[model samples]
Target: MTAYRDSGAPPAADTAGTRRPTVVVITDLIVLAKHLRLLDAAERRGVTPLFVFGPETPADELARHRRDPRHPLSRLADEGLRHVADTSLETLLRAVAPWLRERPVRAVLNVGEVFVEAAGVLAQTLGLPGPGAHAARVCRNKPLQRLAAPALAPRWTLLDPARTTAAGIRDAFSAFPAVLKPASRMSSSGVRAVAGPDDIPPLLPDYGLEELLLLEERIAGREFSVETLVRDGAVLWAGITAKDTNESGTSFFTETGHTSPAPDLTPAQEKLLLDANTEFLRAVRFGTGMSHAEFRLTAEDRVVLMEAAARPPGDAITRLWRLATGMDLDAALLDLALGTEPPTAPPRRRARQVYLDHPRGHLTDVTAEDVPVHWVAEQGRWPDLPPLAENAPARGHAVLVSRHRGDLLGELADSQGRSVSVVLDAPLGTGIDAAAHDATGRVTIHTAAPSPAATTEEPVG
Candidate 1:
């Protein structure tokens, strides 16, 4: 059962004497659950947000959301939620036509991965602030990103799965120990390392015939991502985040953890990374909103671009920044979407998020019941931890579990495989090593052996 019905009529809008300017938010259900705080900020700022869900919510899941009052669809019932048949620019423009007529749209914000292009096109068409169509196109397609900023990108070759044979792929690219990735997927969905020529054919069938793939030179270095807030083609604020991934001894490159204001960089390394990120953002012509650009610092002190995304990063990165610095990134992101100046504050703390992965089995329990936690999406029985003091030397932590009992767990092959996450807040001048260790010790994920007939599969949500 899906949560939405395909009604031709427009969603209910403000019937009050004065209508607030609407910020057309485009996203899917999964991402929507993670962005309730942004909605809260929007309301506080006196902005009306019209949500356009680009994907369907399964009936059972919708029922689950209805059961939890914290879900966005339920909590923001007054603000309209529209289910669009497709995410093309035309479809989105038509779906929001009625609301566009009723209230002025201040911005068209892309909140989910798939809606970036549509949101960009809509925002540009309406002359609003957003990652314009060019930035959206380059950000969405990895090949385009490589083309747009060749200097920042690693050496790579593009292959059309429909036309290129395994031999041709082998001939065109010989950077053994390379990474084969789909040009437009997110969360390392179709990203894997290839040892040599023999690895090409075996993986070809895994991708779509029409999909374009990249054979990129495997960059050996410390991986990091730069999160930047841009306006009018200039960077306002940028922070470096150190990344931990399972790719060290494995073929899959699933990110396991992230720490904000990367604590390991020297003065020179920090300048190089921030400079490279600025160059990449400029190359893509990113107009406004947040840009999460990833890079690798090679052993020889070179920065290589992994990829970039034109949306708030997944895995609570924005939240980590907010907790680490006094800045409210969610509120700032809303302000960017509304074409206003966001409040700024200096960093007074450090924060890290560590994803908990359990052995392959049926998830039986996640032990954090006694510890006070503030759930990011749905609430549990634990008492909520109060917000950390802004000006004091304070430490805080929160636990979030995305899986329930009896769900099957799998290898940490990608971002989706990790179920539980721990976030730690530390006072300024604290190192990431200590905070990360504390966070990892805060939660334990226990799993039980699956039935004899059970097959290896993705975890049930």
Candidate 2:
């Protein structure tokens, strides 16, 4: 269930003067949901934010779409964009390229980096948007991000993957518990938190993979992400957020939403972050769209830049901006991409997003009455939270969304607490194995949610 146009055609121009505010890259809920939040913000302000894309997917996908935590395509806006289904990205560029060439889409905001980089090329090719492919590479690569940080936020060290060693990694950060991460992968793809001499292996991938990783002195204090809009080397309308990261794996974001307007900082600290972000943006040279800038509110109260992506936060944190702060981060991002006025700066109150998760083992069952439920795909992705392709030991877990973080976490904890872990009676063996058509406990035990007090049952031999 994607927010797409079924025409099976690429995005092309429809009317002249019709502004292309911003084109979202990944239409998954996490990113696209921000667009919806912006649209919601705009409608309140009486301005119709416009961008071009495919039309709505089928109704069946609606449930699947809603079930996904990332985003639920606004059926209301579906009619706005022509539905072009079963299309490829290359086709999309081809269709969009020709039309935008004549009109010049004005500004292209890329929510997805791959698409953003691709879109950046298109904009550069059309001479309408941000930097070209050359700049896109520098903005995306980690080693580059590290090198560029000094110009923006903190001062850090870089390690070449090929020649770097464990001893070097330790020496690089002066033997401090350093942060190690892949220069290219997304989410918790290869990010790790290494404490001391012993915690290095997990952080360092030895066998095969890119060697380029940053040995950063893991900063202490609150971790927040700053969402920035860069226009030709300038950072404008920087919105900061206290990010919610997983307890153990620091890379993977378990849940996000936002606290409206973000906690205000001391005037001086705020200015410093603003200054750093501006410098970083200049170094990256992103002329349009959004970027996720990670920073640490250090014990010294200084903002330390962790990482910056040429895109928005992957999870639907923007949605929280809407509910908590009343800011249309998506729309603002769109305008930023199109070089327009701020859209996400609208007024918003308290906001937070949380997920219901199973702390351990297999999920015997999950049920949501009418609301919505979804699985956290490999590494806990929102929309496409598909289980490990096949019978891969259900390593990851599922996520359920709620309006507030407190409620979601509470429900998740409670639900997980009640969930039967192994349900030992049903191993993938004996007559019970693959008993797809059975109904009784032997070969036919069906799916059901047990009362919280239900007793553990044993199978008769």
Best model per lDDT: 1
Clashes in model 1: which pairs? 1-59
Model 1, span 1-461: residue lDDT tens: 13233455544545566677778788876676666666778789788777787654344554466567755556545336667666677777767777777777887878788889988888888899997889988899998988998898888998777776767867788787799999988889989998986787778888999888888999999999999888878888988998989997889999988888788789999999999999999898999989999999998999999999988888778778877776777678888878887977656677777786666888666666344444433332222333477545435366777666677778887787777777777766655566556556656666777775653433221
TM-score for all models, in order of appearance:
0.90, 0.61
Best by TM-score: 1
On the 0 to 100 scale, the lDDT of residue 349 in model 2 is 38
lDDT per residue (tens digit) for residues 114-188 in model 2: 454555676676566554555566666767776655644444576665666667666656736666666665554
Off by over 4 Å in 1: 1-15, 63-72, 162-166, 373-387, 390-396, 452-461
- Clash number for every model? 1, 31
Candidate 1 local accuracy as lDDT? 0.76
TM-score of 2: 0.61
Give candidate 2 misplaced runs (Cα > 4 Å). 1-30, 33-107, 131-135, 151-164, 168-175, 202-208, 230-236, 247-258, 343-348, 355-357, 361-461
Alpha-carbon local distance difference test for all models: 0.76, 0.47
